[model samples]
Target: MKDAHSNRVLLLSLLIGFIVVSLFVLGVRTLVPPDEGRYAEMAREMFASGDWITTRLNGIKYFEKPPLQTWMNALSFTLFGVGDWQARLWTGLCGIIGVLLTGYAGARVYGPRVGLYAALVLGSSFYWVACSQINSLDMGLSGMMTIALCALLVAQRDSATPTEQRNWMLLCWAGMALAVLSKGLIGLVLPGGVLVFYTLAARDWQIWTRLHLGKGLLLFFAIAAPWFVLVGLQNPEQPHFFFIHEHFDRFLLKEHKREAAWWIFLALLAAGCVPWLGVLVQSLLQSLRRTPGAAQERFRPGLLLLVWVVFIIAFFTKSSSKLPGYILPVFPAVALMIAHYLETASRRSRSVNAALLVLLGAAFLGFVPFMLRLAKRAGEDLLYQQYQPWVLAAGIVALAGGVLALVFDRRLQRDRAVIALALGGFFATHLILAGFEPIGQARAGVGMVPAIRAEIMPTSTIYAVGLYEQSLTFYLGRPVVLVDYLDEFSFGLQQQPALAIPTVDAFVVQWRAHAAAGVRDIAITRDDIVAQLKKDGVPVRIVAADARRIVIANF
Candidate 1:
């Protein structure tokens, strides 16, 4: 019966993990608010044009990012159809794998309870939840990093056994190779930081011999170097800007011109871990208070987790450019640390449950005013009308969950119940937030692109004046010629008969000259010489008009 009960608990934990992870995977969608659409469209354009070497947005050379992510999306499109969901599926699946691997690592180091909690925390994290649902490189990069970290831990744990150590070390190198493919040098940088720090602190120089550094280096180069060499050979001009400027200069100096103070990232990390912030803080404090012996035994894992989090924060803080998803690879370690805390607390104190309940209650209350503001901003009066009932429902769930946790604090079964309740509150709050207003706002601007495309001729030269919408370019499936009011925005504009005018007067002069030279059936913004032409008896047809500008095709 004891064995049977143990098996049942394991099955139940696995089942819960599956359900939670599935909720995260299935609930999130492709073409999320910002970067996903841009990346997906770039890949679509690349696949459509059959250009594997250089990434082109609307048929012009775009070298802002490497082609690896675009290549992944293109492959997905080839296997599946070229749609939002198919493009985002790669990231979503990677996120799921990351959650599982995190759980596996936790189970090995701590126990099944820790494993389950780690997966739960990660699956529910706002950052992971948001990033996984999009078509971006971060999810894949995070997965690769998590795999590498887990392999390193396994190798460290098995250092006394040479054969097991060798196997684990091989996995670590393999993971590092994949991580490089996912992002860049930071793959090696982050893991390398953790390993070095661990070795120095624990005074474990013997472990270095077990790592087989020569073999590992050769393997890493063998897997990750060829692609860089091939892609570089394919595009000779890529080296100076891509390698030195983008990778190094961006990090070391503020060349990209995106410097932020260190504390800003600390605030971002706190925000990214939302709802779990209180528990994570407690965990960090607890880890800090450990003695040297305890530190040596568990210090490597904790230090590794800390290093992963700190290095990313420091790296990005010092970088000339920054984005929210850049810090995502650190989330796995954060989740692991939080999971360990929760498991330890559950074993030792009932006060932990009390604290979690309080956090959930606060989170529930916090959403009410936030949702109202979001609804007002999005102009969704109907959501405001329906808001009270949803708020009440969420509050009820939170209260019920809190009461249940308080009532059954001593029961092991109640632990899962409390988790379910917390999950319910989180899901309910986000479901309302996601479904009601924010999504509508994100789609509002691009919603008219399809209509504009339909109104214009298939081969009609469309141009964006002083505006760039990558999503628009991707959906239009044709290069929207950019009339450059600026030179910086010229990279993504297609090669066509267009003038990159620096000023409105220059554009007006050029348009008149082109028209006089018998360039008939030209498309121009209504303000860009079309108005003057209309005054001069030049026939103009309004192709499409939006809140911002008008598209006029004239003869």
Candidate 2:
């Protein structure tokens, strides 16, 4: 009867996970402010061209990022149709796998309850849900790194069995190789840093013996090196730019010019964890109070989780370039730690659970009003905007989930009720965000494409004068002409004269000349420049105008 009850609990957990993740995955689209549209479009181009060597954005050599992400999207596009869904499929799938792996690892190391909680927390994390529904590489890289960590943990746990340890070690190395393919050296560096720190801190030299270093190194090279060598051979000029300029210099010297103070990331970490921040703090505090023997036995995992979080935050904090997604890999460790805390809590700790539930409920309630204020401040017409309904719905669901948790806590055992409520809240939040939010944003971009297309002639050149909008480029299915604005783009334009305009004045002068010479059809926004052109006896037609950008054309 006990066994049957345990089996039933496991089944119930699985059902909840499946429902939550499936809802999160539903109606999802690759549309966000920055990376999603850019990366998704780039992948579409890669699929269309069948050339995987170089990535092109707006039809220029886009050597800024590696090709692994584009390759994944291309493969998916080939299998599925070229739509937002196909573009974002890999990221979402990777997220789901990462959550499952986190749960499985927790179950193996701790117990079934911990595993279920770990999976629930991870799947519902705001950062995880947001990154998973985009076309960016961070989530994919995070997933790979999580796999490597799990392998290492399993290997350590089974050190008595040399053969099993060896297999798990190989899995770790293989996962590291894929992590390299996903992002870069940080994949190996971050995890390696954690392991080294844990070993030294714990005084566990036996870990070195179990690693099988010689064979593991060979496996890593076999899986990861070939692609690097082949791609480097094809583009000899790429090595210095990619390795030194893009990776090392950008992080160390602020070459990218995106510098933020260290405390900013600390604040971001707090926000990223969301309503669970209260519980996370409690977990960390509890872990610090463990006894010596208990600490030693569990300290490796705890230390590893700590190092993962600290190193990622510190590394990016000191770097010149920082994005919220850069620290995504740290989330799994956070989830695991939180799971461990919840599972280890005594049944008598009802006060702790009650306090956490109240705090979470308060946070959820507070978020709704804050969001409305943000919408108003941004000058967005919430009722008319496509995303307004989705955001409002998410806010409503979050509030309801929070209220439900608080109410249910009074009617049942504090620990189980608290866990159930937390999980339910997260599930509701993730489902709303994944299913509705992204699609609304993506559709807005898609709607703009038609206006852009109507203005450009099939043969007339389309150029991004000051920026490269990847979404527009992908929808248009052509290489864009680029006008000079900055040094890098200026250099690129010099290399390709057809894409360059010498100066803004020169461009305006040429445009006027063309207009005088029977170019009667010209489209522009209703701006001061258009008014000036009209005043100067140049005919101009209004094309399209939006809160963000204006679409213009010349015939």
Candidate 3:
């Protein structure tokens, strides 16, 4: 009993350490482009406008995705005040919850050791760490969907009482509703679809009787329906565009312009699992084996996890739209499976795995020269130069982790060995991220913020010409009038045409008019726009310039 209590106290300490590490890493770097900038600015706009239901970007009605994340971001802004880490608070919390839930659920279903190991594995995972620290919609979606999936697994397990099962299933339904709010239909579809496939594949037709669909549907609708109905009613174009264009067309066609081959997700998984790849594969194989009993009588979490992973991969592989983050939902399942395997692995097997991890880390160091050469070719040599030391440190740390794991295994302290490896992987992930901060700094246009902020006035109009560095608006604390550029904001601009200047010529005219009216306005553009304005004989003063863009004023 004393030993058990000591172990619990140690686990609690480790969990708290993980959360503190997550919080520290969250604020280590500036927000990165396109996704981070856009999402943060949307939240900023929502906070400024006090419009929680309608999501907008740069003062235009933006609806590329659902507003749940934006709403969370807005709320975060309200609570914490707007900043880089503040912007990432919600996603990071969701990620932390995901790690805790996976650990707790695994412990509940398997045993205490499996649960703790699962949380550690997931908390240290490369892709999961990176995504969780950024302001992306996918992490929030992944976290909520994980809850729904894990809740259902626990609720329907053989050991659950009828009351326990019903409560857990209701939590599953609530999670599904939040998932839908997170991204869209996939939250509910993916889990529900996986359950259907599992039922059919396992021939467990009686499992449907346990779903409690009537009340579950009510719970799902109660949570998910209000937002859809309100948004659709407020904007008539929402239902058609969101359901049809964003959902169906994105999946069925290449209109969104994001595409990758079917095998991309597989490659991602291989890269993502990195240090634990060999053991994860073995665990997956073990999961496929059934207990010695009637199929319906058995509750197979491994089989459920396997189906979940395969179905998500297959589903996205079939979609025309693909991104690396789409497959994040599978990582938690894989983590639990790997954790279970590691719980029972022999010391010999554990030692071998530790050695493999050491080799992988050492191998990472050898690629640094090639990566630097490629960066030089791409004109990012300075960025790569700063990045090398951080990468080297990460590699060394990982190697040390493996060495420590082996030492622990030799002492028959297997749990300590696993913890060493997990900690190594966790720190390695952050070191790599810290290395990439220089790159993000350059690419995210943060250096230009001070110059843009300097020339600000109440009546000043800002124009983004030919290109939009999404983070610029957030830093400048005001929306820029876009000139001759329409990308993701195109939908929002269509709803309110007055918000955008349709052409460079039109922008020049506006600039001249604003100048005539004694108004100072700035245009953020690329070098080509500068040349075009010079050739057109328009008066311009260069306020600031960076490698990627320039800020010019018409005076």
Top-lDDT structure, candidate number: 3
All candidates' lDDT scores? 0.64, 0.66, 0.86
Worst 10-residue lDDT window, candidate 3: 1-10
What clash pairs does model 2 have?
A: none
* Model 2 per-residue lDDT tens digits across residues 1-555: 233115677557765666566445634553654577678777887888888877765555566666778889899889977877777778877888888888888777656777777876787667776677767889889888888987776777732277878998899898898898888888788888877876776677778878899999999999888877876787675677767777888787865667776787788777666545657776666544443456446336665666677777887887788877888888888888777886655443434444554555455545545554444323454522454444455555555545555565565443445455455446555655654553445334455667767666544555455455556556566666554444444323444556566554555666666656645333323255555656776545556655444556555
- lDDT, candidate 2, at 233: 89
Candidate 1 clash pair list: none
Comparison by TM-score, 1 against 2, better one: 2
Best-fitting candidate, scored by TM-score: 3
TM-score of 1: 0.82
Per-model TM against the reference: 0.82, 0.86, 0.96
